[model samples]
Target chain A: MLKKETYINGFSSINPIKDSGNEEDVFRCVEPDYKTYIDTIAVRRLGKIQRMALVGAKMCLENAGVNLPDAIITGTGLGCLSDTEKFLGNMLDDESGLHSPTSFIQSTHNTISGQIAIMLKCYGYNNTYSHRGLSFERALEDASLLLLENTENVMIGAVDEIPDSTLKITQKVKTFYSKSHRNEPVAGEGVHYFLLSNAKQPNSILLKEFSSIEGKVSYEEILLECKRILLSAGIETREVDALILGTNPNIDELHYQQLQNELFLNSNVLQFKNLTGESFTASGFGVVLACKFLLGQTLDERMYLKKKHSKAQTVLIYNQFKGISHSFFLLQNV
Target chain B: MPSKVYVTGLGIISAMGVGVSETLRSFSTEKTFVRHPEILKTLLKEQYPLGEVRFSNEELKSLLKINSKQSFSRTSLLALIAAKEALFSSRQKESPLGIGVISGTSVGGMDKGEYLYDGYIRKNGKFNLHDAFVHDCGDSTNKIVSYLGTQAYSTTISTACSSAANAIMLGARLIKAGKLQRVIAGGTDALTRFTLSGFRSLMILSDEYCKPFDQNRKGLNLGEGAGYIVLESEEILNKENRKPICELTGYANTCDAFHQTASSPDGNGAWLAISQALALAGLNAEEISYVNTHGTATPNNDLSESMAMKRVFGEKMPPFSSTKSFTGHTLGAAGGIEAVFSALSIRDKIIFPNLHFQDKMEETGIQPTTDFKKEVEIKHVLSNSFGFGGNNSSLVFSAC
Candidate 1:
């Protein structure tokens, strides 16, 4: 838990489903013009993930009215995937040693945050977390720590991109969704950036608390842990006006459906993976939506799993990656 | 008072040798292990010298008593071995239920992933499905947690060379914040064609023995291994009545924000990290007994770090040396390996030598401690780990 209260001042994201209107299961981010945010010449040299992260981070900082943050923290599962592949593929072909150093230089996990800092000329605390599903949560936790350490404002983000080669290789090795689900949850990639501060603002969304667990935790144990977390925050599970789960039309929802039916029966149940698809850092989009719903934004019709008609002042975002890693975030409007 | 973070145990595996005793002996005997590669099957094996661990994957696995049938990346194997040593040195009676594992690595399992992917791409060799799963940077940390058989919370940090330093920093912060009572924090990397070729392409792969802080230093020799330390809070130490090796008194991380690959001419980030870390420890500049430098032996790094040292301790400078002179610049694991060395320096009261140094740099006219010394009244040691992306971190290990 944070020693000081942390508030989400601004948030922005670039995911696949915003304006595609393709009606197909295939997904890719609706990328914006990189030149608008990044330098024109630099955009040509930037990788896809770097462009997406910079645009999202710039928009988020603008929304928060901060030109430079005290710290920059980022998280990613497969960082600079395209560049990594390029460097590796070239080596495989030539075998005469590495050719160009450009791709190799950009392939590090911290490249994104380092580039952002270079662009802003913000020589502050910079860190990157590359844990699998918990990457974004780790970044969030570090941001809260920085805020408690008296950093006025911190810029934190979660960004992951799936190149075609990565997608093909991963699909052959991993299974994200079950076959019985009506809508197959396809692989996804996106960038979500948030500006967090210890000082409250006029329209700040209070980040109450968050907790995560790893390994083989039973569904019942997960629910109990959530209950304990909420209790620690002086709130009851029943008082949670809305529950935003990482559930999609794929997989069993692994007791998430049971959670909705048994516990939050009268509360609005929401789903975001159907829109953003599945990725390690996809839970970040849940955080963005949680903030929006807390700020009086209504849920899209497609996102509703259970439509309980009421204003949502408190939202709990729960996410699990294949029953391996689980995380919960509690947010409040006040 | 805030809780103090203590180093209860230390484990390291570098080219210097395996475990603490071999490493200390290598330092005392003044022997350099940078030699031609015999294990890593890279195309440039004869071109550049490397400080590789003197064990193959099968050898390491067997040494660690791992099942022969299982497939483990060299990175994970090294990490597991070092972490096990650290856990044992900590003298824990039983499995630490609430222990946390935070690891750092630039290339997680690329040692196996490269060959597996290469075989897959060429379609001439078999593709093991299990081998494909270890591609992510988090795989090594996961391996450590599972191998320890503890229901621990773990994460991986990848800030290139400074990764393990950041891991230790985060672990200390978490302990100080009362989030966890104990943590095993460090980093591991295995020699692979990807990184070897990457550095070769960058033209920073030294063909000869790395001479850090030398006038005509060319580049660094790549090394591979793992280093980890058991960090515990004051509360846990008191309850367990354990003797601590040293205390992690201060740590700081700062970015140069100068260039993606090249460091600034002035080493602004390095200076900030060192000064802030010293400030956090509430110690004067003169209190630092020995400084473990981030000298990669590159002309740029030596010059910049020299300037930073000049700014911090002008005239009356303390004895400082780059242990990379022996370890061969372990990239992501450099911070961790150097940290274990720093702890050893405090525990044994010695300063390791900087080998293969001839002439001092013309710019700052600074030279390193060329002779190993023992029985010194060393109270504080500062270790610097700077990496690509301008990430610079410094940690202060103090004697109790």
Candidate 2:
């Protein structure tokens, strides 16, 4: 069977920072016009995750010039946190009486994916992956598989929301650091979306290959596997110009440092967790940052973990959620 | 050119039985698993019927020999049981040959969460935070992967009822694309109060046995179960010199985008998914020997699925039935269970009956096969699973 090539045609994202409008305006962090896309009625009903996802999805579709996608796939770690927290809190506060069903319904992990399908009127494949940090990467893998099978247009994304209860839980669990260390710590809400296609466009980036690694595999073994994959793709180690790392100042710095000191010692390393915070699906944001870097776009200095390298050809995005699920994607500028 | 994906082994655990043989026997005997809930200790047990598996959480944990001390949710236990059976049935001695496990789950650890919610809030619960770890839908898949002791390419798919079918689809894609040699694909979801009450709130849980495609169908009876299949690339199967039970001929997933919780009146997503699956299989609708309809016995589902069946199969639809009557609506696990059942049907050359059906649906002239059938030359089987948010999926199985 002949393999079909897949490419990332367009991408869009919405974060706490003002990043959705022009490519140059991503550095600006200002309040968005949430009322413009969402009305008071809908806003009151939606959880933070849903609202961010809807806006990000809309931006992605509009940017991709795709009116209706053939499939909608989403990934999140803790889905609809606001709703889940609300429902759980109500159960705790009011002893479960007088509890509305709306929060419970929205709390299901697949609600966002279902909502996207409903919003797009797209009667195609819809799925959501919620495997901690690798959630979005898994969704991307699914989209790539569909595109490889000749499915034309796919809308894929990852979204996470910062709910007060969840934030408290994270703090309790030590998943988040103090707010004073905001420069290097804590998780925040954001959504990143991509329109994928098999046919390459002038402005598109080619997805060369992707793989998910699990369990206690040695870093050397992972590097060897990555080397084999790159070799199969007819590329060499030194040919790779940049590596995008999903690093968090508080939690992931040790692992990022190990990666930097070990396998990526020779390559130009860049990190993005500072800009997007440490959400479970923030790796998807890392993918967006890699694409922006490959496109010769500048990012906010706050997100930079290492010096910027000029003229990167091949970029590798490596992300893992809490050291459980690891994913690596090799991307190249077209 | 399209790649061929083969189904090598199947494992299932439902109210009917623990393995494929028991499930098949129950199906042949026209035995229905629907009864008054005994396993789920809920106040509504007396008022509603459920498809509960007769196993305690401790018994399940002991059966699977998980010693994490952290309480395993019913969903994780069921998934581990089914996944272990799948790997064992595959007869593979290798630790990991680039094998992956993709399981679908809707309510991950809600069972445990609901049980310990108050205690955790009060800070006096015996619940380990790690016990609450499984609450995320994906954690169930992670637990399954850990239980199997194999880590290659594993992930979880959550599309509600269509989840396992999507898992199967992804597994097949990975093999066809030469990404992985083998994958354990399926779904597991245990019934929980969260889900039961959610369904009750929606008024979709029937108080009696479900009647799919029946004119008087009220709603579906919820059940809990897990099913998984071992899928391998042709190259791997050929190298191993193994006989495949069935070939995964085609699969497709489509979203209705019609409603958040209801299928479209026209079954647009169902129609597209079925049509796409058949087209990928390179077979006409008439070639389908049987269809495991996603007939949850819900009024909306039966009507919408019937319309979609008519649109796809036209006037000459094949023998179709909803096994949900036997296993109840397992939500994310339904697709996996039905996929295993479809493979069994092809292997045994038998058609399982739709347990509770009295009359034909008025919206469509579709009547499911109500009697057990045997010794038929089954060639192709199609299965449909649609879920909340209009997510729809269809899979085709053929004799190898």
Candidate 3:
């Protein structure tokens, strides 16, 4: 029910998959050379977490052809986990009151976005969303509101770091899978950023609609919300060229698959968790993939379960985790 | 057409007390709860004083009837306590038009996360993933969802101290934009050694009672608690014949873009935010009856905020005071708690005193309410909440 149309100008995704040097069946990001993007001063002051955030944000700005953004918004579940772990380890080891300010400064969830703004000298509006799965979507929603308010350009970044200690604790419960032990969903980390505007461009993808629902939602309710998003976009269910589901790949959880079959039965369905791995803000990578497919107008069969559609005019991203926060996004080629 | 947003209900739990009546009762008297914390499990207990909430985790769980064994963070516990009070007091727990939640938190469940970190360092073979789940910023929000029943939207904001103010702004925007008819917007934060040590590393923790807007102000004392406000559209208010606590007329957020930790000396961001907030409310500098300042007593903040107030109000500055003198700086929850206090001022027609203010700073001519006193005919109250990363926000509440 928005009166404005948000455009996806430029974006960058730095995860295990992209950072992966070779094409392995497993997912991981082969990181870009940080030495090239960041200067020596920042390199010495920042940690790995801040380095990735800076690189990812700079890539998007360069691609978008903008120097200073009007606003900077970010979404992260556990921000700068490695630095946080370092700080906490000192406290537990009885070595208190002895440490550098770098770890402590970067440990905050807002550090990613704040640091980015500081680097760019952007005095504009800045915010960060720290919700679990809904973090990225919330940031996007805030951007949409800004666009509606006539703010020209906004930058949204979704970044979360996974530390070894965190992985050890969660994997003990079998919540996350390992690369060698491939049956379960593995934990992932990435710095995904986007530059957006209200006006349409030649290569812009129309962010037609984005919606999220939470609390006491039933499977039927999720299906209904999906239908509402498509309906609001003036697109028929059968007309959707591809269905990109953000699933955790749990074979027991047939709810998403069953709902997809009943709704968009003929559309080619695909999943992204295999390539992007799993993080709280993985939806950023998902939406970026959808936009890339819409812009490229082609798909690589390896990333898809059903390879019926070769060209995607419109792509729908359906994502939910543990049946908690469910979100639907509709993207179309402009 | 967009409808006006109203504050139908408010719930707050701080070091002062629980529930609105208790907080108001404590506020009415000459009692302010600033002391060495008896509750927070910090190793620096002998070093820094705080305004920590008194209830234990078990006591809070019993009050809500939630099982003690459940993986509930202390942050979530405080949030649930305050949120439940707002819901029941607003009588909108079962709003048919759907309710959204926009809660703010800086560290989420870091208090619990710190213990898990201890396990990781000590090489403790036993590890519980439940603690990992509780550490997420959204975990407390999801818990509230299960307790609050059906909701249309849910999200968490983490912009340090300005978080709750931003949450309240978003809730009002949603209602005005007709995206959501009702919302529970505010923030909650719990104290932890991780945060306390971080502040200590930054050397911003004061050893004595925090003095706001005073000449001899040293630094800030970190506190913990949760505060929330129930926002409803005019249609819902009319449908239920509910009286509003105050009209949330204007709100704005602007960043200093200066430093990560220190505020700019010119107070440019703070002035922009306060001016923009006034513009949104369609009020002038002279109409503001009271100003609840974001005075953390830290030298940098008090000076910058004073300059910003001068820039906006010129020579006719309204009587302003920092309630933080009563409640130690609550970080992300400061905005929410201060907004509640601002509403209370409008509802009670009184301006609460700023405690421990002996001398005013030499910068220009600004003085806090030197004594605990009450005032009449207060129409509108402006509250300021500034945070690190230059994330500053201001809110205006007016009587209906």
Candidate with maximal TM-score: 1
| Collision count for each candidate, in order | 0, 4, 11
Ranked candidates (lDDT, high to low): 1, 3, 2
Q: Considering summed lDDT, which 10 consecutive residues are worst modelled in model 1 chain B?
A: B116-125
**Pairwise TM-score winner, candidates 2 and 3:** 3
Q: Is candidate 1 or candidate 2 better by lDDT?
A: 1
Q: Which stretches of candidate 1 lie over 4 Å from their true place?
A: A20-26, A176-184, B122-125
Instruction: Decide which is better by DockQ, 1 or 2.
Output: 1
Instruction: Please estimate how well model 1 matches the true structure, expressed as its whole-model Cα lDDT.
Output: 0.87
User: After superposing candidate 2, which stretches have Cα over 4 Å from the reference?
Assistant: A1-5, A18-31, A35-44, A87-101, A178-185, A222-242, A261-269, A308-314, B1-3, B93-97, B122-126
Evaluated at residue B21, the lDDT of candidate 1 is 85
lDDT of all the models against the reference? 0.87, 0.79, 0.82
lDDT of 3 by residue, B155-200 (tens): 8999988989999999998888888888988989998888888777
TM-score of model 1's chain A, to 2 decimals?
0.94
lDDT of 1 by residue, A1-334 (tens): 6668999999998988664343544467888887777785875777889888889989999989889999999989888889988898888888665589989899889999999988888888999999998999999988888887789999999898988767656665654422333344577888999999998999899999898887668879888988888888999778898999998665566679877776788888888877788788988999998987887876577788887777778999899876777899999987
- Report the lDDT tens digits of candidate 3 across residue range A1-334: 4579899898887877642333343344556798778784755666677788889999999988889889999988777788888888876665356456667777778777877877887878889998887788889999899888888899998887777777766666555675545556667777889998997778888889988865447878888888888888999988888888887664345657876788877787888776677777888888877877887745455468676656678889988765666778898888
Candidate 3 residue-wise lDDT at B237 = 87
